[model samples]
Target chain A: MYVSMRKLIQLATVAFATLVAGASLAADKGLTFGMLMVGPYNDHGWSQSHYEGGQYVEKKMPGSKMIYIDKVNPADRPGLTIPMVVDDLVEKGATVIVGNSDDMKDGMREAAQMHPDIKFIHISGDDVLTGKAPANLSNLMGRMVYGKMMSGYVAALSSKTGKIGYLGPLINEETRRLAVASYLGARYAWTEVLKKPLADLKFQVSWIGFWFNIPGVTADPTQVARNFFDTGYDVVLSGIDTVEATTVAEQMRKEGADVYSVPQDYIGSCETAPASCLGVPYYNWGPDYVKLFSAMQTGNWKPTWTWSGPDWTDINNPDSSAIGFVKGSALNAENAASLDQFIQGLGDGSISLFSGPLNLQDGSVYLKAGETASDKQIWYLEQLLEGMDGASK
Target chain B: MRMQGLKRHLFEIGLILGMVVLFTTLLLSLVGASPLEAFSHLFAGSLGSWAKFSRVLNVWIPLTLCSIGLLYAFRTGLWNIGVEGQVVMGAIGATAVLRLGLEASHPLFYLLAALLMGMAFAALWALFAGWLKVRGGVHEIFAGLGLNFVAMGFVLWVIFGPWKRDGIASMSGTQPFPLELWFPSLPGWRVSPFALGLTLAIILLTAWVLYRSRIGLNLDAVGRNPRAVRLFGLSPSRYMLLAIMVSGALAGLAGGLQVTGIYHRLIPSISSGYGYLGLLVVMLANFRLAPVPFIALFFAALNVGSIQLPMMMQLDSSLAGVIQGACVLSALLVFGLRTLRKRGPSDE
Candidate 1:
């Protein structure tokens, strides 16, 4: 009895010391960052890039710690709802929670309204812009529209059969805008850059109606991509949140089909299929978040609707930019040089694809001749521009 | 003697639960988490607040209804694994009625009509599976599973093709039903008093039907010996079909409540695997009615509390599933051992 009592006293002392130390450590921690991901951390696409951004914040900032909840999507983890996730994260001492993905918009907005003290950064949503979000919530997204245009330009130049197929995921303003931008780039590169007739170049976009591949609800992207190859779309561009384009292209290439693919949302995604990847138009979220984190630490953070583009000087810089297009192994040297020139022209304001005589899918005038499209028009693009052979409505 | 038997049963249940707790703690320790803190967080997150407990009740309503519905089918010796499909079909039915723009009418009429439509649609779906099992000589498991996939495809087509909002399809689901069609909530909580009352009614009804009705004896007879049921001049298939339909209707009503009470729209994952979870609940209840609601609430607590694992402890929420699976497994083990002992030493 004496030995057991002594042991219990010793254990209590150790527990008390550890509790105090933990409290002190938590108090001293500079900024606690939490991230919510819709997919696994290593998905090689959207979620992976967000995870890397979290890692970058941890590395670049001092006296800070980070935690992330991955695979938080409802389709797989049905029992976990967004409000529950948010409450738990807030209880665990997260000052700022980054709700990644447009699918998480409702949950993010609801949580932000419920918890006004904690800050929320929602990526790729118009809730902030439309004045529907709480003051504590801000929307941040990259200008991937331009990068997707660049993808179209490269895919057009490299395609042997001028037919390009876009594996689309859902029909929304964001997706419609991106698909239209790619077609714009494809038409310009085909008629002006490649000196090909407009009739010879074809771009077809198919909608799967979800961000990732859901087997039953959405069409299988891999099968759709393989069909694109089988039916003569030599260059397929991925608009979904998976590296299936590169993987599918690599498999088809092995089977002796001349096919190439453009991946979305990551610079290093070419490693998935080196021989088939043309390039990737990836979101570099680290820099903007780091700035926000710094400003927040100093108590000067203002909720801004950030629709940032790439750094003109160094597109590959991990800071101060939202969008970057990374060239891959399959891009030929000559094609790469031309694509670089095109990007430089875009940077210098010499080439303007949005400059107009543009028409809607119904042959209605969208932009008057010599009138450039405004940010609102581009951001809320309503339809697939005229001449794309696919359903926009 | 009765008291002694009850005591032995209670003691065995306690032993199984103790084994489950020990196993789960050992697993958490393997993942480098303090098991005590993990368990405390779970209890606090699930039952520590009125809001949290209400959410647990919200989950419990659907799970309990589905489990009780499944019990009817189980007692009739029918494997109605397509309860998930029935739930989806229910949502579709409710959504169709709400689309009629009849919110200006009496709210109770709208609610009753929507729920009835939901049950009717789900009954039709379940009857199709029953037909396949009886006529085609196909296994009910395969038929139910296949029909579930078909129901998913049907929902997808409706959301994308016919009922798409404003000429575009999205993952956000069909446009929300007008506010008037939404189920009235309890004064200060997210859950509806109507929904809670509905659940209680269903539970009491199911218990009465199972314990004090002639149909209960027929179902039991069908499960044990269909030939014996036939000797009584009652068609076994008719009773089996009745069991499947009643199960589907309950699941469908739960789905309807989800649309009118919770989400207010038909999302793709509206059912969210509650059908499967309900199966687990019934299994853990040892195929009895009285213990189902309690078992379901326990499941809900585990599921709702597990969100904290990922948030507070950086642990995977799948660990909740592991704990639940372990509990059921230990119960099964204890039950098997009891049966062996009852059979005497020579039987083994």
Candidate 2:
């Protein structure tokens, strides 16, 4: 028995040595980037866009691999923290790590401080601009306000009841600004394009307190959407990270309601309910990710807050555009043409909805007459604009 | 005879381990993964290097603390289902103290004060349940479960209202405390030695308190026969409340450590479900204090290592939970079989 134990010990030592050698060999191969997604990879919304962007990076840069772990939220994977997962990714030979959520701000900041040698990219975070990020940490986000404007424009064009509902996720600066942008576009379409009085149009926002449903935690997005359709609202624009608004609109349409919905974030969000989808204002993160990853690979990367805008030459160009609006099959030709005009006006700087005479919900002047708001003013919009219904704080 | 008993005990443990391995292997094969690769990945992910092992220890700290606390309640035949809420309250209490001491001179004093406040708050929360059970005759399970929901709602309100970050109300939770308020750890160490040392000392104290003292005997007597314990002039209700309060105090300490040592902030999921996971650990340890620490360590290793399954094999990390469940079921089966063998055919 003692001789057999010694033989087993010898065999284990040989196996361990072989495993270590193989691991070291694998480590020398290529550049591996790690992605931490806040939702499932195939959620067909925000997280899916980021996941596909990672895929794009692998295809664009040869010998560069992408390793990702999704559903990195506390509700999904309890007891797991950002720094803990970052350590695992680094151990797997990932030189650059991307965290794709604003909710990951503190954790990413902590992890960035912990690993000064590795590059960290936090999406939709202001840490870099706020001067709170380490030298190795950068922030990346698309100018989604423009996309939300298009969504509101289309929702207004498609609405029969002249009432539009916004399905907002949480009441932060990002959600508030996006919701306001959508309302501005809708009001512009109602007053300027359709030649209707502003008072006849009803624009309201309902926040679910999170990007997605957490059952007992957040207010259910599905129920919130149904409540919108059950009321006189003929159009609902989803500002959350999921397709619940579109799905609910489809279900309500089947019940013979003349309702339409516009989903946000992913390019393919319209596919969930094509007949009811007016259009989707999606973030095409591929071009931005490729640019950043390439810079990191070539060692020319510097930490900067990138808020990329769409390529006006061709908004749907996958290689150039950071944001695009895909017109759904439900959009009539006449309205679609008008929508194209609105897009052209936006692209050429002919339309600037943020120019004000704008008042906040509390009757405070946000911008003086003929005064175009600065980037900081727009980015840190504290309250909903007047004529929009929602809790600002 | 003693040697034979020891041999039988070892055999039962071996049988349980074999069943767990067989069950997990079957599960991996059903998912089209190589069982050997999966097992090796699990081992390497948890115990590969010092960094990984330190993370596992971080998980083990709270888990073992909760498990040891559950032992006190279990000894008195109390089902402390409110341990989860108690942990949350403890975190809230700690955060309250830490928030006040954000700019204080001595960080260590505030840290100690925060942990004590955490323990005090959790003990009060547990005592309310005990009071309802002893006085109002409400079942402890129902009261505990109801309080869990209340605690959840209370935490959400606190996070989104009074404790929210300036100009931001989010589920991401309150603003993170500054690094100065963080529980100090040694360089290159993820797990705080102070937290680890405290947990070890608590475990030793609990073992002594529950097994080697008169209070321990009285608690056991109360659990076994409350009516007969009255002859000893001891109040069973008081003992019950005392046991649960002690249990809450320790669970609260776990929460305090999670805030100060791990998160350094009051997040919505501060407990990380360690309270519930501790229940599982205590159950799998067969409600024995001696095996509680080891079982918690194993579970913690599984929780930490399962991240590799998703990264390497494209498998959901819930497989770790499945393995945990299988081990508990297999141990129960072996335990049943052992009892049957000892009873003989005539006993039935």
Candidate 3:
């Protein structure tokens, strides 16, 4: 028995040595892009949108392949850092890597410094703007504020109750700005469009602490949505990355409650509960990904922060738009017509909700009369607007 | 007689290995993957180059430390399931010190101080569990498990509250420490040499303390028969507390290294489940110290290599965890069979 065990060990050692030699002999042959996703690729929300964008890249560019690892967050893949995965991807001959999470800012920066030759695209980061990123790294995000505004517009148009709830993710500049944008749209629809008294409308925001639920880590979105519905908030605009708002709305409607939801992120999010979904403000990353990858391939890529907005000529044009909203089955004909008019006004610059006499949640002056918010002001919004309820910091 | 004992040991090991391979291969085939290709990918992904091997070493370092720590607690017959909480407290303590030294000079001094504070914190946490067991008569397992939840809650609160970034309340953790505060490594190396040296020193010290000293004998006696140990003028409770504190110190050191060496910030999961993995490693080593490091290296390699499964084969990386579970189950089965054979069916 002892002799056989010794022989077995020797044989295993030789096999492993040969395998190592074989691995080194293999070489890269094509343009490979590596994608790291914070959630599962099939999650039908944030990560899936990025995964589909990678798939779009493969179809558009010949001889290019995508290698992706999803669920890249610390909770799901503990002990796996961005640099470690980047090392593996580089070994596999990837020239471009996309990290699809704001949580990856530090690790992506570290990995970008480690591999200056490889180009890195970190979505929803300000590293490039902040001058903290290396020259090889860039940032990309859709102007989702417009989409969220449209989402709020539709929700306010279709609601029977004037109370609207915003189911928010963690408190950050990005989420804060988005939530505020939704509130602006809802307020516009409630007062100017519907001719309702300003005191009759109620808007509140509830944050669940993270991008998505991790069981015990984040508050369950389903429960939060149910609370919104049970409390006479007839419409809930989801600022999270999942379809839990629509799903809960559908469950509530079945029990004879009239509630509507607008899910965020991927276009197909409403398919989970189409009857209750008012619309989805989704990201169309394909066109931007193709443009960026083409620039990288032609060696004309300069690291820049790109916050692309939807094509005004056709917001839902899959071939052109970076951000788009799709109306769900629940939107009534009159509300849908009004929503189209609202979109037209936004596209033509005839309406600007950010112009005011605006006060922050603390009643401090945010914008004076006839004063408009600049891009920086909108991007770094410090508090929820007056008449909104939620934690700001 | 010595030759027969060695042969039996070899036979038991072979049986365990064979069972693990068979079970894993069956799982691969069931998933419609070629077993040979999967095995090769796992091996090549982990050991294909120096860079990859260094990553495996990075995982092995902490895992081995925790396993060695577990050895001390096990010697005194304490479950010490609270090792996970101890690791978190250690990370919290290390981060507290590192945060203070963010702008301080002589980063090396701060780094050393952080490690010692981490150890002190973890030792105190472990001592609480020991106290509950020795004085309050609460089972260490329950005390440890409950404390683990509290530790988790505390880390979450720290990340989302006081340590949050300027305007960000995120689970991504505090802003990273400066590069100077990071555990120094060579230009091309992924693992810090200082961490490697410290781990090696700890292993040697543990071996001496657990095998070559009078304290080792007393702890072993306490484990086997605490009442008898008291008759020998040795306080079993004292030895139990001492063993648990030492275990906590080592686990804490692992957490400290994870911060200064690996993560550079206090992420919510800074411990990376290494504490539980250590429990498995020590158990699979059959409560012995000799095989602990080897088993830890194997587990670490599996962890590092499993990344290849997702990238190359579109297979779930959890297969590595499944393989690990199979190995431990197979070891338990082999040991059970050996005991059954020794008793010649009369025990049944």
Candidate 4:
């Protein structure tokens, strides 16, 4: 008994010494955040925004250190499972982990359960603190739908055939609501504001399951653009990051389709397609990046959705307003005037995306047939009306 | 002398090391990175912490299992090259069970389904080669190669057609299997216990079976000369088919563990180059059981390290491919020299 007492006393001393050492280290250490990117930091698409966000945090916080790992194709299996990556990051001293993909939800959930001290912020997923997850795990998505609506107006105004098609990725809540916003915005401009008969307008929307070109599929935006133009829709809108849709517009120009295009990140699409592109609906992803991390630093970040978009201004706007590039390839006179009018109206808020009596493609009442939908209800949109061609359960 | 063989191996390892250094240096230079900086980045990225070591094991476990399995067939001189197909078919079988609601509440049933179905599926695929080799006097390699294309066709047909996710792009996968069915991720380890355990069991069992049994001696004779074994009253075809069966079963086990333990669903990406890598490993180890894991881990380190190198070095992940090709080439050179010396002028 006496020998055992001596061992217990020794164990207690080691525990106490380690505890005090940990306490001292906690105050001295810099806060480390990990960013898990689906593509290279320079991808210029989804990963670029997250990289910029990490840089924003680096600039904003004095003592916060950012570490990143990228090109984490979910297929690099075994130890590279998304959750495994999260666990490794947390184990390596990151207090907060940022996973920039929706497919990472299960991984984030599993990692959060394993390490309660580590906070995981999964982008564009529906899972948050309450159901099937804990307080440490949450999700955030930007309201790019508002930006998509603005792009829709650009297409609606540019269309000469009175028909326009929107090419989007996946029929999930994100793409579905964005597609709805695009059509609703266009119909608002074409029918309600222009005082045109509802039956005179034609709009179509289709979705491909992924964000970029699917090599073997007919869903390539460039191909879909030809589909729309051949079917008499002169204007095309793209909801994906790849420049395929704009490339299709460039192709259409070769044959005199006179079809216009709204490509997002308009300035950056040149890697593949050229500047016949109209303005893009780009994300001013800077604000939320600054806001969320600052809140995290102050221990004030909460599980609430923040929508930051629709800031239509010059490309140089600190908000980086989603700008439509003026038609670069010889904008013949009348088209220029039409494009400017659309831009000027959007800039002043004289044009609204959801001033609706949003009707189905079959002319059936969706939002009370003749009355406009409220700003609040538009944010919670669920389904696509008739002009859209996709389904989700 | 064996000492001469040792010196030759050492020289060959040096040549492989030189090739890898030159390979990465060229890649980094082309990407506008200083090769010195890229080397430092490679070191820092791969050996940066213990977590990275865990990532190495995650890759090592599966690769080791596959290499050891391939070693079995190579020992008996049967070119059981359909390992890739057998692995995929086996994974598809296990996933089909989960799709039918055979949940992991019955662990024994799940494990048995995984192993038995893997063996059965792989055996069925192997039967093609067996039939061709036995009945038509055909080469198993060509038959096995054709079967691989069929497996790939099967995977694509499901992804784009019937098994497609509703309204989702035809991404190469099924829904993640129910979590309860996943093999336990080892505590503080990225690899599943099932992978590590099964690989170890197969390595040990194979070493014992091939080295200690009388059938092993007959297999050696059959591999050396079927006519000699035929006069010895042994059926060489039976031993040859047995060797292929063992090879396919182990490869199928690897596939089932991959989908269930690692991927959580069948993915078009799962086979990767593991079966091919396994072939290189068997050749390098000279089909010895003891050194297979070490060789597999060396390749695994290249894979795990490549992910980190791209960011720090500005080099593409394909640089790992260059290093792997270099290693295999060097090992082949050493084997070629050893074999030539055995038939040198003195023997002639």
Q: Among all windows of ten consecutive residues in candidate 2 chain B, which has the lowest summed lDDT?
A: B5-14
Model 4, global lDDT: 0.67
Which parts of model 2 have CA positions greater than 4 angstroms off?
A1-29, B1-20, B317-321, B324-348
iRMSD values, candidates in order = 2.5, 1.4, 1.2, 4.1
TM-score of 4: 0.82
Model 2 clash pairs?
none
Writing each residue's lDDT as its tens digit, candidate 4 over B122-167 gives 7677776766786788888988888887886786567556666654
- Displacement of residue A11 (Cα, Å) in model 4 is 30
- As a TM-score, model 1 comes out at 0.87
Query: What is the DockQ score of candidate 2, to 2 decimals?
Result: 0.49
Q: Candidate 4, residues A1-393: lDDT per residue as tens digits?
A: 999999999999999999998986674357788888765566555666677767766766667777777766544332367776675566557888888766566777777888887777877766652366577776766666655665666666566678887877654556667778777667766765566766767767766655655454225666776787788877777776555667778777776667777766433543444435655555544456656666666688666544445455563364444223434343346645765576566668676555555655445665763466663455444567765555532
Residue-level lDDT for B237 in candidate 1: 84
Off by over 4 Å in 3: A1-29, B1-13, B317-321, B325-348
By summed lDDT, which 10 consecutive residues of candidate 1 chain A come out lowest? A74-83
Candidate 4 chain B least-lDDT 10 residues: B309-318
